[model samples]
Structure formats: structure tokens, C-alpha cells
Target: MLKALRCNSLERCFQRVTSLAEARQALAEPQTILWLDLFNPSQEELQDVGAAFHLHPLAVEDASHKHQRPKIEEYDSFYLLVFYTVQAEPSPERLRVCELSIFLGERYLITVHSEPIPELEETEQRWTRNVRQLEGGVIVLLYSLLDTIVDQYFPVLDAMVEQAEALEDRLFSGELRQRSFTQDLLALKKRFLTLRRIAGPERDVLNVLTNRDNPLFNEHALLYFRDVYDHIMRVADTVDLYRDQLSSTMDANLSIVSNDLNKTMRTLTAASIVLVVDALLAGIWGMNFEYMPELHWTYGYALALTVMAVISLLLLLIFRRLR
Candidate 1:
């Protein structure tokens, strides 16, 4: 879907532009700014918007493709930025990330995404609430979008922290008998890895937006971008920290499992030893000897049984003390 919001100094409020023709006309208005948003657009829609805006082929291609790295590229008349919006999926093991491609021109900003980004919606509402400050230029609007995206990471990180804590608790509580425990732990690690991959480059992207000599970004906008850069840095650091913690947690869990297995083996060995002693006594008594003392004397059979029971009890006590 395609949507457009047009803002101008004279208008004092955002005006809806319904069609590409209207957007093009609005672009000609003095001191005007335009935002075009496309969500889950088809190939034809992308081509139409790309052609209408005379967007660079590479930028348009990047928008069509999924899994583009987070970065910003300077085109002739605009900048193409690729970033991701992340949310934890219903399954705690997986992260849901949506790639958003933005074309930031002097007077317009066009955003394309295959999936819905709640940040964009929230940014729009924010702009509506603070139009006096954000509506002055597209740069400010872009700042708001970036700010929203960066802020969204914290909640996901918080959820991951809670999940990691829960897993750690479960690990210590002897729930390792569950078959899926290790798999879940590994999945959480993967999610953190993915978060790092996304946030690290995003920090660089923000760095470029703040430090690059781009005419589109004014001093005020650069400051806002710097603030966002700082936020992304924190996110990257958090990812790294959690990844290490999870690794340690996994190692501890492995050690616990090994210790438990060793205890089981020791128990089995003790049982085997007691049974072997009883078998040895029975074997000696069962020997075929016509002159054997146990066969000749009536009390000999009772004495052999008593000896076996006493040896077995001694072995059991020794093993119990050793354990």
C-alpha cells in the first residue's frame, strides 16, 4: 500500500496526498515536504513509485530485495538507508525483524518495507503531536523515525533478559531432563547474535547520518541523529554482554549435566558391586564337591548364607559412606 503526507510551511498541518500525481504536484510547492510510505508493495507498485520519483536503480533494487545489511548510501540526489525493525516473535526463541528501506531526498522521504513497521505509525503520531517542531523539514521527521526505531530495541532486550533469567533458573532447578531445554537456550543465543548483527551496523549508519557532510541533514537533525547513534551503541553493547552470559550459562548447564551423569554411573556401579559379591558367594557354595564341608554339615549352608548377607551389608554401608 502507498500513502502520502504532505507538509508545507504555509499549510501549518499535514495534508494528505492520495496519488503519485498529487505528490509530484505537492513537491513543486514552495517550502513543501512530502512523505511517501509503501507497505508490502508489489513489483508493479515499486516500479511505479520508483519511476515517478526517478529513484536510482540500485536503491530500488535494494528495496525490492530482503535481508539487505543496515547501511546508508548516497545517491546523486538523495540517500538510501536500509535498517531493520525488530520484535520478538510468539516463540521466545525467535526474533521477528522487518527490513525498511528509505529514500531521503531534500524535500521528500520515501519508505518501503515488506512488513508493517509499528515505528513508522508511531512516528507519524509523534509528528502529529509535535508538528510545530517535526514538520519543519524531512530531516526532523527522519530523526523521529530513527529515534522510534532505536527506542523499540530496549523492550526486546528487556524481554530477552527476563527469558535468560528464566532459563538460568530452570537450569539450576534440575529441569534439564526436558528434551527441549538446550534447544531453547541455543535459540536465545541465536536471537542475540541476530540482534547484534542488526544493531552494530545500524550504529554505523547513524554515525554516517550524523557525521557525513550531507546537505539534507541540518545541524539540529545531526544532533538528533547523534542521540540515536548513542542509543544504538547501547543496544550493541547489551547484545554482546547477553551473548557472553548465555554462553557461560550454557557451559554451566553442561557441567551440571555431566555431574548428574557421573552420580548415576556411580550408583549403578555400587549396585553392580553388591550383586557381584552375592554371586561370588553363591558360586563357591554351588561347586560340585562330594567332600565339601558345606554339603556334609547341616549348619554350613546357614553359615554361607549369613556370610553372604554380612558381606553384602558391609559393601552397601561402605558405598553409602563413600557417596
Candidate 2:
């Protein structure tokens, strides 16, 4: 699906461009800036967008595929930027990553994504709310959009930390079994690693946008992008810190599981020893080929029963004290 919004400097308001022809018409206006968003575009739709905007074939191809790394590249007419949006999944996978490709031009901005991003809607809302104050350029819009995407990392990180802390608590609570405990830790660890992989490179993308000398960004826009850069840096740091925490959590869980297994083995060994004593006594008296003297005695049966009970009780006490 394709949606277009045009912001005109003279009108100081946002207008929706319903069709490609309308978008082209809006692009021709000197004081107007257009934002074209494509959600899961089909092959024909991509062709249309590429032809309409005169985008490079390589840029369109990159947008057509998924799993592009986060980076910025300069094309003939515009800049092709690949960025990742992440959310926490409820399944064992734990992390869901989506790629968003942005085409930034002087007069227009185009965004392509295979998955829906709430940040896009948030950026639109922010733009709508502050349309009158904005100077009707793509730079401010890009800043707002990038800032929203970077800010979203905070909540995702918070959720991951909360889950890690919960697992840590359960590790010592002695309530969780072995299998489920390990799976949860490993899943959480993977979540942190995913966040690190995306956020680290995204920080570099923002860094280039901020520090590089680009005529597209004015002083105000540079300030805005720098703010975004700062946010992504913090996100990168948080990801690294939590990744280390997850490693430690995994190690601690393994140690706890091993200790529990050893304790179980010790208990089983003690129980088996106690059972072996009774088996030994029964074996010696069960021979019937030659008559056993104790078996023929009057009180022999009671004496054997008494001896078994005494020995079992003594072994039980010893094992309990040792434990």
C-alpha cells in the first residue's frame, strides 16, 4: 500500500496525496515537501515508485529484499538508508526484526517497509501536531521519524531487563525445573544479542548523518539528528550492558542446575545403600539346601526382623546427619 502526505510551507498544513499523479503534482510545487510511505509494496508498486521518483535501480533492489544491514549510502539523486525496527515477540523467538528503507531526497522522502512500524504512525502524529512550527522540509520529518525509531528501543530494552530479572529471581527460588529454566534464559540472551546487532550499526548510521557535511541538513536539522545520535548511542550501551548481564545469567543458571543434579545423585546413592543392607541379610538366610541354624532357632525370625529394623534406622540417621 502507498500513502502520501504533502506539507507546504505557504499553507502551513499537511495534505494527503491520494494517487501517484497527485504526488508528482505536489512534488512540482516549489514550497511543498512530500512523504511517500509504501507498506509491503508489490513488484508493480515498487516499479511505479522508482519511476515516479527517478530512484536508482540499486536502491529499489535493496528495498525489494529483506535483511539488509543498517547503513547509509549515497545514490545519484538521493540517499538510501537501511534501518531496523525491533519488537519483543511472545514466542520462543523473543525478537522480531523488520527492515525499513528510507529514500531521502531534497524535495521528497520515501519509506519502504515489509512490516508495519508503530513508529511511523507516531512520527506522522508528531509531524501533524507540529506542522505549523516546522519549516516544511524533509529534513525535520526525517529527524522526527529517526528519533521515534531510536526512542522505541528504550521500552524494548526495559521489557528484556524485566524478563531477565524475573528469570534471575526464579533461578534462586528453587521452584523452576531444569528444561524450562534453561530455555527461558537462552531466549532472553538471544533477545539481547539481537538488540545489540541492530543498535550498534544504527548508531553509526546516525553518527554519519550528524557529523558528515551534507548540504541536505541545516543547522537545526543537524542538532536534531545529533540528538537522535545521542539516543542511539545510549541504546547501544544499554544493549552491550544487558548482553553481558545475560551471559552472566546463563553461566549462573548452569552452575545452579549442576548443583541440583549433584544433590539429587547424592540422595539416590544414600537410598540405594540403605536398600542394599536389607538385600544382604535376606540373601544369607534364603539358602535352603542345608538348614541354616538361625532359621531353625525359635527366636531367630524375631531376631532377624529386629536386626533389619535397627540397621535401617541407623543408616537413615547417618544419611540425614550427613545431608
Candidate 3:
């Protein structure tokens, strides 16, 4: 989808442009310094856009396909920047990531995405809901959009920390075994690692802009991006802490399982000892000794059975005391 936002002269109005002619028309307008967009152009659309703007072939390819890492390339005429954005569906509990390729021209900015981002809707709402006009300049809009996406990381990381802390409490409570809670912790650990893998590199990407000798920001809007970068750092640190907490949680679980197994082995060993005593008495009675005078006595059977019962009871009492 192609979206154009014009904030140059008076009120802010958004336009949807599908064709190259319309895009070029928006780019040609002196007032149209900002363009927020998503493009999944086909073969024809790609060529048309490339020819219209004199876009480099590599930039177009990078925009079309997914890239392994975030990057920024300074073309002779324009700047090609590849950025990553994450979408967390807090309701459905799903996470989706995509790359955003931005073309920053002298007067206009173009953004391309492999998939749609709800940040577009959010940006619109921020503009429409407020009575105050957006301040600074075109850079404000650009920086605000980036800032919005980056700022979302805080709540996500914070939520993960809360969950980790809760599980840590449950881990020692001796109640985690009843609720499939251990499995839940493992799943959370996986998600934490996933979050870290994305956040770390993306933080580094933003850090470049923060440390840039001549940043890609206007003097007034620079502070906002710097603040956004700081939030990114907070997220990285939180994820790392969560990762460590998870390792400890796993170790605690293993210790509990081992303790349970030891209890089971002790019970089995006590039963085996009783069985050995009974087997010895039975073997002596079955022996074919011809001079066994007690075998002829009618009370012999009763006496032997009574002796076995007493011995078994005595062993049981001893085992109970040992336990």
C-alpha cells in the first residue's frame, strides 16, 4: 500500500497513491516533503518506481526481498536505509517482524515494507486525536514515526520481566508442578531469547544514528531520537536480565525433580529389604531334610507362619522409624 502524508503548508492530510504517476506527482510537489508508505510492488510496479526515481538496482532488490541484517547505504544521490520493526499482538499474543526500506531524498522520503505495519494507523491517530499541530518540520514526522516504533519495545520487555518474576516466585513455591507452569516457563524463555536476538542488533542500528557525526536529524528533533535510542538500550538490558533469571529458574526446577526421585528410590529400597527376608524363610522351609522332626508336627505350619508375620511386622516398624 502507498500512503502519502503532506505536512508542509497548512493542515495535515493523507493521500493514497497507487500508480507511479501519482507518486511522482506527490514527489514533485514542493509542499510534499514527507511520504509514509508500504510497497510490495510487482515486476511492472518495481520497474516503474525504479525508473521514476532513478533508484539503484541493489536498493530495489533489498527492498523486494528480506535482508539478514539492518543496514544503511549512502547512494550518490539519495540515502538508502534498511530498518527493522517488530509487531507484537498483545491480544492474540503473537510477534511479527519486518524490514523497512526508506529512501530519503532531498525533498521527500519514501518507505517500503515487505509486510504492512500498524504503526501507520497509529501515526494517523496521533495526528488526528490531537488539537495541537505537529511541530519542528518534516524531520519531526520522520523522527516521530521511527520513535513510535522504537518506543513500543519498552512495554514488551517490561511485560516479559513481570512474567519472569512471577514464575520465579512460583518456582520455589512447590506448586509449579500442578499447573503445567514449568512448560510455560520454558516457552517464555524461548520468547525472551527471540526478543533479545531482534532487539540487540536493532539497538546497534539506532545507536549509529545517535553517534553519527552529522546525524540524519534536524537540531530540534534530534533529542527525540536520542531518547528513543535510550529506551532501546533499556529494552536490551531488561532482556539480558530476563535471560539470566530464566537460567536460574531452570536450575531450580532440575533440583526439585532430583529431590523427588530420591524420595521414590528410598521407598523402593525399603520394600526390597522386606522381600529378601521373606525369601530366606521360604527357602529353608522348602528344603528336603529327612531328619527334620518339626515337619511331622501339626503345629509346625502354624508356628512357621506366625514367625513370618511377626518378623514382617517388626521390619515394617523399623523401616517406618528409619524413614
Candidate number with greatest lDDT? 1
Clash totals, every prediction: 0, 0, 0
Rank by TM-score, highest first. 1, 2, 3
Choose the strongest candidate by TM-score.
Answer: 1
Q: Candidate 2, 35: how far from true, in Å?
A: 1.1
Give per-residue CA lDDT, model 2, range 236-307, as digits (tens).
897788778778878887787788899999999998998899889977777775754666788877887888
Model 1, clash count?
A: 0
Return whichever of 1 and 3 wins on TM-score: 1
Which candidate, 2 or 3, has the higher lDDT? Answer: 2
- TM-scores of all predicted structures: 0.92, 0.87, 0.83
Distance (Å) between predicted and true CA of 203, model 2?
1.7
- Candidate lDDT scores, in order, read 0.88, 0.86, 0.71
Expressed as tens digits, the lDDT of each residue in 178-222 for candidate 1 is 658888899889999999999999988998888887667778777
Q: What are the clashing pairs of model 1? A: none
Model 3 regions more than 4 Å off: 9-18, 29-31, 89-94, 125-137, 176-179, 288-294
Query: How well is each residue in 1-323 modelled by candidate 3, as lDDT tens digits?
Result: 55566544345555555555777877777666556475665656665666778889887777777765666677766777776677666642455677777777665667787677777567656644442434444555556667777777667777777888888888788673544677778878877877788778767767766666554466555676688778778888888988998998888888887788898898888888887888788789879999875778888878888888888889999989988
